[model samples]
Target chain A: MTGLPMVVSAANLPARVRIHEVGARDGLQNEKTTVPTEVKAEFVRRLADAGLTTIEATSFVHPKWVPQLADAEQLFPLIADLRGVHLPVLVPNERGLDRALSLSATRVAVFASATESFAKANLNRTVDEALAMFEPVLARAKAEGVHVRGYLSMCFGDPWEGEVPVPQVVRVCKALLDMGCDELSLGDTIGVATPGHVTALLTALEEAGIPAAAVGVHFHDTYGQALANTYAALEHGVTTIDASAGGLGGCPYAKSATGNLATEDLVWMLQGLGIDTGVDLGRLVATSAWMAGQLGRPSPSRTVRALSHKEQ
Target chain B: MTGLPMVVSAANLPARVRIHEVGARDGLQNEKTTVPTEVKAEFVRRLADAGLTTIEATSFVHPKWVPQLADAEQLFPLIADLRGVHLPVLVPNERGLDRALSLSATRVAVFASATESFAKANLNRTVDEALAMFEPVLARAKAEGVHVRGYLSMCFGDPWEGEVPVPQVVRVCKALLDMGCDELSLGDTIGVATPGHVTALLTALEEAGIPAAAVGVHFHDTYGQALANTYAALEHGVTTIDASAGGLGGCPYAKSATGNLATEDLVWMLQGLGIDTGVDLGRLVATSAWMAGQLGRPSPSRTVRALSHKEQ
Candidate 1:
């Protein structure tokens, strides 16, 4: 990885980007229907086979909270043996972390909301309370030699609270990073982020002593600004991006949170920009197409739709 | 416009942009079901009412070629008196130009291909032959004191040729500019362009002595790169953008040309960036929704889908 040339100038962006695939967890958690455990395992394997190195497998939250991912224990062991891939599961608290550890999970993620409304609605706690809840989870994961990721949701806007201030997001992000998480993923959970807002937040993070290297952007395509915001983030020297296969996932909280930035769409732009993502776009599109068939709907990704139509 | 502060830096982009709304012509041109002439005029009026200053009204191509726009002659006079809006019509040749002149059309557009295969398939002529055919039409329009726009199609890639060379596109764009066309719209007809390709082409255009002001970008959303490509164009200081209402239009020649860049999508990004496009985004979204109902399908625009669903 160090041997490859790095082009960080405005004219030339980073030569490579780390695509953090979140299809199995973030993508399916909001889904209304419960996907069978066998299909969930197969989805993770296909994503890895398409050259995706990091795939978030599932959440270990209680079934009462997220019924769609109730079979995480059954799902994890199915794809845990995939070679050269990092499969991370979401663990909200110590109990979830305990569940992850029982499965011998190598990596785990904990999520916190930046806005009070989202924290209260989504996590049933205040912002501070949510962070306090993750404190022990992070400590246990660190003590167990497990890599941990922290997700800051509603970093751009909130459904109840309009536009989230950049400083507010930075403060929450700094708290998460200081809590010993390996990296932080800033999520525009409501999908209202614009390029300027993304730029402002990334700049604020830099000023708040959170380096771009420790940050990844998770944008929803509700307003079709995901790719544009990603472009802005890349120009700011961010090399990690979170995307879902087949553009899966919608926020049950905000019906307008249509889908995450599709991995195929991200791969298309990266491949065109001469950035190395190591993922095979054709196979990725095929995988999304197959998933769409399973889900009984066309993928919401323009690249997937276009490529599939071309094949026909 | 002068009262607005102009931002012209790499980090801070242009303060204003010109949105060349093309729903009336380019948007409805490829629809399988013919839109009524009265509805077409009303669509143009609604777009203008939404604060768009320039709208392409209709095309005067032969009825057999573009039957959807066959009512161009009748559609022109109905909206000719629209206040503060520049209504341009597409004219294919001397005959079409004559029709445009009879209606006192102030602005006209002629299209040429950057690839030979598209030229032969769409225009039934070689690239040079198509340019020659437009020569007399451009001369007549210029002699009559009419504003003209030259469209260079397949500027990014050709279905048959694949990955068009920048030099080849530059030469064709140079020819169009040299022919007294007031402005040139470089089209990613197949939606195959990435930001890097956009930047490279714009830089090459600059090196070829064509100012960014004379170039407008017309991107299709087949790969969902339209907004990102537009962002790249703005970074290069190109401000004029061509979009269609409700993300109308698909390419008949290229099966992958799913939709044009929706004006609402572009407006959403520009408004968020604090770029002054003088467009009412709510009104634009409503117009697109109305048009979608008329077209008997949901809009393909993510912005429109998000906003409309939010209202529900």
Candidate 2:
């Protein structure tokens, strides 16, 4: 009662939990004002310092479309200089992949939509057409010995299409995996997907012979189902999860989209489950606090905000 | 394109879900200004109209402790008049029991804590002492044949004493069951409990011969683990859940305690799982909005607050 007290209830936990940090690409992409390249670099450096092994450095999308990540070239080199960090970049098309390759990117991810309508709206192509485009990109990346992560957006529901069929999502996932993508990230672009949807989809995916380890889940907090969906994936043995630091990012297309799953909240959850993500909770909360200060906004991550206030 | 705007991926849901509405008790307990008895009765009536079957009407404690529910006697009669509604009142002592009995209460609940420190601090007595006090109240209530609900506080973790042992929670649960309590509500008291702890505790309780049907979970969203913990509880077949409408209410006894689980958010999760709680989502959101307007503050339920903003 006098000093900081320690109460030990017998401790037991999962051996490992992988957190694929999405702040650089997803977090910054949704910001109203573009962050400077130097700030982005520093954010990546701080993330590394906070023990993030998989830090998404930036995206190679067109500047006209996503101006927030215009300095992807400059930021990649900054993160590439950091030790023991796996810096991955988002590639939208052939041009994006070319830029990523020109930068000697060892790891690059290509994002397309699961539903045809979302593919057209978000990527300006039909689902088959997007897959057709990603085909050559993946083949070239594979030939170059670069790791390719394929992201299937709007897997659960689509803005224009309403409810997307699970089989359609499974079809897209199969095409991406067959195209030699090392991993697939199923996205609930609007954050409307629930645990039941996640459970059903993942079960379907597994039925299609897709290894659980080959999948990651990207969730939005629009409907407040992101964390629940993430836990559903974790329960099914998903090793990779996409979360943004400080709960930054949202889909421009999804009207209710607010923020991504907060890295601090996810870590708080995993740590309680005794899943080691090799990240420090105090340091992670501090980084989120700093970024929240810079953005002049509170983090959507409840644990980070709570801890920061408590510390104050 | 115009017809039913097809949703191809709707969740394959479980048929039925039981909603234990704690709004009247938990929702009003945290407000700085005491709401009038007429307003409380009207609120209970509205919730029942919205199809909340089990509504916690008010607490029968001394007004000196909980000034918010000073008019329990006044509120009970009005609530009891609502047709097809099950009104449950909290009885902290024999005097409280007598008050509830005077109103011909259909259901009465007793409160106790699993942790010794919380039991002593919150109730000003030891765990055994509190149980002994409940014995006479239980005997009188049983003679009258009123349904008794037992609230096992600090079942997961205690603020004063950090991690609660599962056996302690199990023992308290057993004592309540042995005392002829119809249902046992496990109160998180402080919101520091995680899903893992909840799973472990529920598993232990079930292992100790307590049927899942006899158990209910009351969670606080302080640490943002409330919903996840609730889901974990759901997986163990817990039907009845205690939630505050609009995520209102906090324990004044526990410093830094936050509101109970938001009824709106919990309904969203349940409905998404295809579990029918017999409560309308839009109606629940509207009720929270009306309450928030009266309070001159935002609703604590994330789904309610978010959806209300979108509606605007």
Candidate 3:
């Protein structure tokens, strides 16, 4: 069904999208209770079985900070042998990278904040200080042949700082790419982004000599703009979309904010548009339902709720 | 702010959009418990005070069928003197139209189904039979100098008949226009529509010689596609949108479907896009929060949830 004309008017959108599944790492990391290592491994396996090419397995952050993902070492090795999938772990610094190297991990990611307030609050460093901290991490990852993804949080709006300027985000994005990160994921940590903000940011990135292919968008649905923001990104030819299964990982900073856009919801729109994501949506929905059961609560995803109810 | 360039790339979108608030009539009618007439009147007053120019006040359906809206007669006169607002009521047939006329309602709406299954299930008539029934109601409404808005439900998909053809929707839309409805509201009753389906339906409507100005789009967030579908409609120059404050009115037929798109969510996007909606978003969010309190549940709207949290 790929490349079929669903709507000739939306012809500007790419024919295919690369979904970067962040459920296990970004999604579970925010859970109040620690997900068992076995369950985490199974979730990653289920996502891969659903045809996801990239599954962020876990974070190597110290257990003191993100205790939910303390079992990264145990979880990563269990899914290491999964064929034809990329299992990337989040590494906060050289120490985290050292742990990843111990496991012989082939891919890892580092996060920085676009706004100074978010950097100070989230990373305990200023914006420039956070970039400086990631410098050596990306350099060592490149030397060790590990793929590096740079995450810039608060790319659109900041709670303390209000509206973030486009130029500031562009400068930080350039710094990450200059340090040898293969891709950049623009994070709307507060979910305050709109389609216009998305277009302006992407346009600025393109003007700064970064190709759209090197950019991915990670949006929370706090203000119900994630899918619309994703649509705007796709219009600019950005194919890498970061979504969590079952809409997991609500922002700890924004208490009432929703989780990442549900992968099933994004896939529904893509499938309807005749854009290929290589995902079996039914299996994905089943995977979310399973996870929702394990969490002892209903999933926050509207698509999950709708489809699961239909099944019953 | 209306004409200000939000994103030069999105300059094609309409500079202003007219929001048709449906929380009072379409929303409350589906609730299990009947709202007090005084509260219903207050809801309408709040919605209008928030700068919503068009508010659907009540439905004149039989009290036996929809006991929730049985106090339409009492609710109408309470807000009948509100200035600078259009209060439209739903009139199912001549009896309902007479009730609306007795209340001195200047604007009224009628509903038809795009699929035969929904027409039979919802109105106890076939698609053609439903249109024939509306013929006289619309003609009488025209002669009374009352504006008529036609609602075409199940335009995208149906529970009994899946994937309704575009031609079927176009034909029904033409019939509604031919019957003298000043405007037609295309409804995704099952919430199964995607952007492509929206584009195809609107394109077919235009091909059938119906201008976009004569159309409004009503969507449910059932599969989480309401906002995205609305975006597609706006891209095609659709100006009027139907939304329910606090995301009221779940689909009785599709038990798990969500209510109409929250007016707060739609306003958040339009405000961020620099489009004029004339709505005080803060006031609108408060209104939804107030209604949610009365409904004894948290609102399903992400915008309402997020903003209300910020206030606290």
Candidate 4:
């Protein structure tokens, strides 16, 4: 029993969704073990083969910041030949942007914090300073004929500051879009968001003249609200969803807790809704199972666990 | 940080949801360990203290079928003193109903399967035969002036049956309502349902004259679809939700997998939506923590894992 969900479509949702697969870049960055360069390249290839079009390949951040993804230069060229697949890499600043450009990367993304506390804590700068820092990177990427994506972290709530105001998040989003970035991915960094808060943020963005087409949602499963929040986002007409394969991101505090929405889980919901994602569920599960075996642990995905059990 | 989700209410949802906590009966019934009668009593008391108005205490089925809760006669008397809380016990047939009525139980429920495969597998009887068997039980309970809840399992998809039809589920629901049931709890026993399927079934139930107020949703989390399906049910105006404390039910094949939706996770979502559930989140977390300790394992709930870590 492959154990797929039965199809039943709802009204007002997009017939097709472009899943922004972030397993290699976002998922493995938080891992305790550093995977080899060959495995990382193979992972990107497998994700492409599974029919994920927009796969975030890796980060060009300083090795000191994310040592796990330090093999970006060695890993990119290995999977760069994947035709018809959009491999988006994260570029922290102009230095990282230069590195991605050197490799002929066509798509790049820069992450910014919505709240001041996270800006200071994560990037050692204020909100404006962080945006100012990404200015040159986005400008250079746009000049180089590369698509740019802006990731707005802490859109829902921040750990240091309890509940984030929707207006405050909207300001950062507008600044990012104005700074030469093409689209924005709203990140619930700590996974503290609920459906209404998700709706509130998306509605606020709409009021600020941002359409749902240019927005993607990145939700963590820290509190098990990711899928429900994703459903709410879809209801608001946001089609691009960011998910990590096998729910790869793990909480540093609790190893058992998942830090990202599992891609397999998302595909199950989409498949059941009769929405086309173009990703083969069987191949995706197999890829996650292989990746989980490499990490010497089980994937934090319920769909993976449930389906993989039947195959065995 | 207690890691509580910030409140942001959704539109057109119920102002308050009735949480039918089923930790003591449905949750513990799956465990291989036999919890003592005193511990079960204390668990019920603690759940009441945590502000759960309706707790499914224990089942009145034969000791041979459910050895874990065979001491229902003893357990019921111990917690009957708790005021202002509704304790619903499951009664399988006439014998089980007789046991429940003799114990002076105010509320009783009968479990049925919506699919023929599950009906044959679980009860060793056809769907019609199973319904006929419950006729006398439901009638006797009604005559005793007790509230009857009809539980229809495999409401969405069954493992052996794949996808259960919306019409098929509605037929059983109508049968239950006609046979003296005050309400129906639709159970997605395999956790394979998606949002559209949930809405479709709810719509069919309404067309069959079963109002949302007369329906509760019981979802498993095997494929991580419970919370998302729950949101869909909420959108369709269903107010009563069934959850297990500490996510007590575990998949026998995969211990890491959760078989029931966690009450803490559901509470976090409800509280974030400003939906009044009369539940104290802090106390509920502590109660689940203590229950997890009694079971000699960490809770499978992400909310339990996230919050309990901060407390420690």
Candidate 5:
């Protein structure tokens, strides 16, 4: 009947949460079509207009690896003029870090794997070897006085390895934070996690002296557990949540789902709980609906579909 | 990677949960096309075989009201021989109750609205008038040694009315429980509730002397808050959850969603938490997939979609 959600605040959650918007990078990477440079640039600008401050602009990987974002150089420059926003670029290695630095990208993130299977499959290196690779990148970024985020994939599960051990994840998270990285993002890449696993990981990290404040959660809605997992993380005092605009990363209908949690869905829950995310829900929905038209499919976010349909 | 969720139990949760399956009744009533009586019977039989103990088979309302389930009398007898299952049919009034009692239905439910707006719209009676109407029905069911469940709709939000008050809901719940209903199912008709609002309501109910054990939760996924809200209810010691097989009631693609929480999605979370539901995930997925084929569309359940794709 209507588009908006009724606000009813929950307790023991952070007063304000900082959403790390990843629609332009992670979302497009999994898309079937390669979005144009101008459209991608406009997406970042629109995301900022929707009040998303930390929009992940694009990844600085090699063209052969991520051909979709080959225009990282061109894309970054177009949105570089956007003020009051922190644009973080994914830096795969020292060379990727060099490319980001070349564009004057002030924030960069290094991707690591909590499990060995993901490390070898994704980076062609073992967990320790990948950590060794990021050492130079993080050190250089720290030396350059740039903000750095370390993303640990397969924190809860791995394809080759079913359930990753909490202690194993804790060791890798410790290594990243102990190194020159400023913060960490726990990735439920396969989205097999429940609330207990999330609480266990966060508790382990806390015991290892990593405060929940320094960590962000990146959950995939593969099993419809992303929002529930987000609620658990929020209760544990996490301040950062990574979301894709329009749930753009992977289509849920596909067998191999890279379904990042939808940003609009996350905003709806946060706003209902009275947790301020500094996001304008209406503008965000409009941006996602517009992007869905560009992609030639309906936006997967229920809130986006519900609201946009009413306007139509 | 795989279809199954990794089991990791959270503490302080109930050891087992009893799911009240509503696919045959709540799910199909909102469908654009009406299902045949034989198919509806087979659906209930399949649900029982898949390990759902309590199934809401159909409503005894008049055909003019819900033409989709006009064959309740013809449908109930076909599955009455199925053993060890409770088939609950909705009895709208004295006529509905008489029809259900003729079929030897041991369990029946009466629907009431927590808000005046819904009471007027759905029942054509005010809140107290609706309850007054059920007074005779509850007494009759009690006299017949039948179990009665009181369903309080619009407990969270209303379309015409934005946010519902917690006290108003508790007062209605107490009325139903005090009258003769053994238990209550609180409905989030619009699905606008946050986790905090859920906890606040349950706490309020507990303060009113309604133990968490005597209540169940029914959540809709209109804004995708169902699972997270379910988790909140579980934390508060709720043991009964109402779900629809294949998420039958409403299509998320439709603008006006009557999306019931998918049974498979709930099983995924409950199974991952190492909680016993006695449900076979593979069989349940197959059942929902088969039902989706009957409905000429895919199931809205993310787990059902993800798991069935792997089997293909």
Candidate 6:
């Protein structure tokens, strides 16, 4: 009863770790069939009611690139006035940013990649070109008093390029921070990282003079190391994380990609460690069950499946 | 690169962590339908072929208590005499020990509980009474030159009593060691332990004059913290671990007892961090898939499932 060893920092534990629910945008984007706009909007409301302070409501990408998110215009305005929830939408380019801005989005996210091959495969541009492309959107958002989150995909490893270099990940992080983005999320696009790799990357970022508090980790569970990696990130002073409910979403291009880390599993681990995440476990389970019904299958989340079985 | 930061004890790194496979006995004990004796024997052969050095082949409990293992007499002799492999059986009382000795079992296990209520409910005896029951059996087994391992169930928490105290767990450990048991396994029986609890218990054991190397941890994945708990145990110098392949086994009496820590998942974590376990991942996956088919469902091992999907 020595009141938990004082080896780690306590000041960094945020009042609440803001969960940016990506189930609607990043989650639905990889679905084979297009989800109806109304169904997407209702899911957004259900997530908000489950104590989520922020949710990525939709992605305003071109229909050619992502037909699943084609109804972003219809879904964005439906829950725009929801109380106490910040709705952020993904803006792939200038056109996408304009659509989000037209709906009066308070927060928007822009994407880039750490490697040239992944950038070309995912965004139709080289690494430098993709980073340069987000400059205008970031500038426009900053001028209009809107917050922007910069996403650096394939931070640790890439599908085509194999092991991504540490300097490449740091260079993208610095560029995004310099472009007036408020937060930068380092994504493990293929989820090959172990806890050791996560600690090394975060330690490298700190040594490179990047603010640890402004960084978030997004992981896929392809290797079953996503939650363990998240724990390592917490040890390194990361406060915000990106996870999808029911472990939804898979890459359309990569053949072996799996869903992101499930929100229920992350919350379970965090709450058990007595870290505050402001999530209701019961509601989280119910919402995941409802979403799984919409997807016509059970969730890949171990926590959701285990708790649901208990209720039955 | 400061070289991985040496998170856990890697001095034991590259030293093969003996994964005492318990799938044959602990797994099938709670299964609903009785698998044929030949199926059980075949499972042991495939597991041995997968480079498992120690496998708990079966138990000698009466058919009325565990009907699933009633065919142990037939399955045991058939799977014996494999070179470099040790087949152990669980012996509850003198009758059970006599049964195992008749089958020429070289290794035997006795069960005790850390808490009085769990001991009474699970073994129909008090804590001291349960230990007393094993004294004569140990004497008889020693007379025959057989090794014995003692299982301390509910070392972390229990169904009847919540939050098992560390002192109680340590007392049980000392008793088992004093009784001439060669090894001791600490179980979370209900999967209610976090990493903090694991660190505290193992630290207490070291302070109480017990050699850390004599301990093994058996965890259930009910709360999704079993692997983390195992990591904490390894950090304290315990090497041998009890795991069921494909995350098999659950307690029939405990309400929420789910799967054990999956062997494939454990091997993946150990090998990724450069710990040797002498296991072939491909062959272990094949064995798990084979047993899963017999059980009429998929293996619960996430690593096997994820890797099989990649291979396909």
Encode model 3's per-residue lDDT on B49-93: one tens digit a residue. Answer: 999999999999998888999888999999999999999999999
On residues B1-312, what C-alpha lDDT tens digit does candidate 2 reach at each position? 111112222333335667888978867877775777887877887788778999998899999998898888888876677888789899999999999999999799999999899889889999999999999999999999999999999886776777778898999899988988999999987666767777778888889999778999998776567887787777778888899987777432222337798888787777777777899778778887787776766666667766786677
Query: Over the stretch A142-251, how does candidate 3's per-residue lDDT look in tens digits?
Result: 99999999998989888787778899999999999999999999998888888888988999899999989999999989888898888888888999999999888863
Top of the candidates by DockQ: 4
Off by more than 4 A, model 6: A1-16, A31-36, A250-257, B1-16, B250-257
DockQ of each: 0.43, 0.30, 0.46, 0.70, 0.61, 0.25
lDDT of 4 by residue, B1-312 (tens): 346788899999999999999999999998777899999999999999999999999998889989999999999999998999999999999988888888899999999999999999989999989999999988888888999999999999887878888999999999999999999999999888999999999998888888899999999998899999999999999999999988887632362375789999999999999999999988898998898888887787888888887886
Per-model lDDT: 0.85, 0.80, 0.87, 0.91, 0.90, 0.78
Best by lDDT: 4
TM-score of chain A of 3: 0.95
Runs off by more than 4 Å, candidate 3: A1-9, A251-255, B1-9, B251-255
TM-score of each: 0.95, 0.91, 0.96, 0.98, 0.98, 0.88
The TM-score ranking, best first, is 4, 5, 3, 1, 2, 6
lDDT of 1 by residue, B1-312 (tens): 111111212365888999999988899987767888888888888899999999999999999989999998889988998999999899888998999999999999999999999999989999989888988888888999999999999998887888788899999888887778999999988888888888888999999999899999999888888999999999889989999987888532233557899888788788778888989888888898898788877777777877888777
* Per-residue lDDT value at B164 in model 3: 82
Tens digits of per-residue lDDT for model 5, A129-248: 999999989899999999999999999988888889899999999899889788899999988898878998899899989999999999998778899999999999999999999999
Location of the lowest summed lDDT over 10 successive residues in candidate 4 chain A:
A250-259
lDDT tens digits, residue span B1-312, model 5: 556777778889899999999999999998877888998888899899999999999999999999999999899999999999999999999999999999999999999999999999999999999999999999999999999999999999988887889999999999999899998999998888889889989999999999999999999987788999999999999999999988898775575455999999899899888889989888898998898888888788888887888787
Candidate 4 interface RMSD after superposing interface residues = 1.8
Off by over 4 Å in 2: A1-14, A250-257, B1-15, B250-257
Mark the regions of model 5 whose C-alpha exceeds 4 Å error after superposition.
A1-3, A255-257, B255-257
Tell me the docking grade of candidate 2: acceptable
Q: Candidate 3, what DockQ?
A: 0.46
Top-down lDDT ranking: 4, 5, 3, 1, 2, 6
lDDT score, candidate 2: 0.80
lDDT of 6 by residue, B107-136 (tens): 999989999998888888999999999999
